[model samples]
Each structure stands twice: as structure tokens, then as C-alpha cells.
Target: MWKMELKLTDKLAIERTRLANERTFLAYFRSAIVFLSSGFAIIKLEMLREVIWIGYALIVIGPILFFIGLFRMLYVKKRIKKSYQNDPD
Candidate 1:
């Protein structure tokens, strides 16, 4: 239960934080997709045979980046909820 009522500014600030979090997650997701796509493209293209290692590295890094973003987003979301719930102001 909320200990105290929230003012209009407080509510707006919280909403802004949530929106920002979503935007950040989207950015991470977009980057992951780009990396994954580039990795696959490089691997499939015969002209880029010399730097195949880079393609493999990118493939591995893409999922890691996705998971990192996922965890960070969830952690921040939970923290925000807990903070507002417990705080009196």
C-alpha cells in the first residue's frame, strides 16, 4: 500500500522514468538485432572470409547483450516499483 499520496509532479516523474527505461531497452534490443544481423551477413558472404572470426564474435556478443539489457531493465523496473511502494513521499 502507498504510505502517502503522490503529487502530480511525482507521478509525472515516475511515468517519465518508466518511459525512459522502455526507450533504453528498445535501444539495447535494436543494437542486439543489428549485431546479430551483421554477424550472419558476414558469415554468409564469401567476400568477407578473412574476417570470419569477427562475425563469430559478433554472433556470440549479440545474445549476451540482449540478456544484459533484459536483466538491467527488469532490475530497474523492480527497483522503481519497490521504491515508490515503500517510500512515504
Candidate 2:
């Protein structure tokens, strides 16, 4: 009975960790979309002819956000794997 409970708990923990990782990635994706959309809108609409640099900056930032998110997701996954190996219930 104790072993069964431990197995269930470990499964829950792994699932929770996966969900958290997914949520974090989604958050980053959302931010990238917002930045990319705003940049495209600014450029297409010519919203700020005098300060076009801002639009360019945002466009650059969008990809950076994506890469950062990807890196973070990989890092977290690795950490989780290590932890699981060290103390798997």
C-alpha cells in the first residue's frame, strides 16, 4: 500500500512539473506574439514614422524572446530529469 501511494505521488509530481514547463513556454510564446504583432502593426501602419527604431527594436526582441523561452524549457527539462534520476519514487 505504501509503495502504491508513493508511485501515485511520483506520477503526480512528474505531471505537475510537465504542466508547469508547458505553462512557462506558453507564457513566453504569448509574449513573443505580442511583441511581433505590435512591431508588424507599427511598421505596416506607419504609426511612428519619426521613431521607426522602436518598431525595429520590437521585431528583434520577438525572436530573442522565442529563443530565451526555448532555452529555458530545455534547461528545466534537464533539471527535472536529473532530479527524477536522483530520487525516483
Give Cα-based local distance difference scores for all models: 0.89, 0.83
Clashes of 1: 0
Residue-wise C-alpha lDDT for candidate 2, range 1-89, written one tens digit per residue: 13223476787888799789989998999999999988887887755887777778899999999999999999998888766664453
Alpha-carbon lDDT of model 1: 0.89
For candidate 2, what is the lDDT?
Answer: 0.83
- List clashing residue pairs in candidate 2: none
TM-score of 2: 0.83
Off by over 4 Å in 2: 1-6, 86-89
Query: 72 in model 1: Cα distance from truth in Å?
Result: 0.3
Q: Least lDDT summed over 10 consecutive residues: which range in candidate 1?
A: 80-89
